[model samples]
Target: MAFTVKINNLSKELTLFLNWLFSIDIQANMPGKSRTFRCKTVKFWSIWPLPPKVEEVHDVVYLDGIYLARNLCVLICCNDTHVLGWYVCRYEHAKALFNVKTMDQAFIWINELSAWRMTYSDFLREMTVDEFENKCFTHERLLKAESSIWRMIRQQTLFTFLEYIDITVPTTNNRIEGGVNAQLRSMLRAHRGLTLERRLKAVY
Candidate 1:
């Protein structure tokens, strides 16, 4: 009986290890059936790798949200090289991570400029050569005039990175958006059989 119990324990450990390998394969963009066949295991087991804790502060951070479902989105935070962390929340709540004061100021500017009753295109058309060349029509000022149209340009941090001429910061979060989030979406698409809980685990 003791020998039989030892064999059962060994089998359980092997199963757990295979499940972890299965998760790794899935994350590496392997399809469900393909990975299961490669691992020589059934597709019932699922495991999620725990991300290492990040304590160091980065010079520049980029934030973007990727929608997993109609109402659910994962807010991804990353620097140029590595993903810092992510928060899963409703699509509307994703804006909570943004600088509230800056957003409020943008809204105020939009309201003030709305009284002009001019379209963004019209404003551009009427710009003088000096105003355009002298940077009087800066993105911040011009974009504020049409906040509804240039929603992202109003963010304070969007161009603040440019102020630090000494540091190298990317103008766009394309790395996270294109590299990380895009891969995640593709992985989810490949593993459509995952339940909601498993999907969340896979995302984590």
Candidate 2:
């Protein structure tokens, strides 16, 4: 067993703030047997003074649309992985949401489960609606422990992306992601301790 040294409230908050800067996932309830999390938590955001998060690097990029991007949420992917799929995110809400432990696992699992999807534009084909439902349900049941959010995603959004891939449609919704966040930070740099609404509005 391990233990954290006793600290005052302010000290603890500062420790967590440091964790978020380096993309370390910490749980108040669990000690460090893990480096990642099974779900999104409040511990991931930056406090003032720290620079914005540095997103994970990928072979390519994507977005979920303007509103989603502006809200500090975006979906990102690459052709080498999904071949036009939505997978990565700014904060990896997908991984945490899906309860997948790491990018390596996510890539393998997504590719294995979704590989049956057709990849050619000239010959568009789809699993029958009945077949799709059955497969999703089967996978969902099999991987239920993996992530409830992932199961929900499989049942709801998987087929939609599959159809788009079959027709060679690009999966990315073009929009500024980290760039938007950077611009907001720069704009707010000179300001000090503004109210939440005012600060956010400036960010927006």
Evaluated with TM-score, which candidate comes out highest? 1
- Candidate 2 lDDT over 1-204, as tens digits, reads 999997555555555434433332334333332243212323423332222343555533443322233444323333333323332223443333244445565556576545423343223222334644552233433244345646755675433333333344433333334454344454445443445544543333
TM-score for each candidate, following the candidate numbering: 0.47, 0.26
Worst 10 residues of 2 by lDDT: 120-129
Cand. 2 Cα-lDDT = 0.40
Q: What are the clash counts of all predictions, listed in order?
A: 0, 0
Model 2, residue 75: displacement in angstroms? 9.7
Error of 2 at 105 (Å): 8.7
Q: 142-184, model 1: which lDDT tens digit per residue?
A: 4553465445455554434445668865656788888888878
For model 1, the run of ten residues with the poorest summed lDDT: 92-101
- Please, what is the whole-model Cα lDDT of each candidate in the order they appear? 0.61, 0.40
Scored by lDDT, model 1 comes in at 0.61
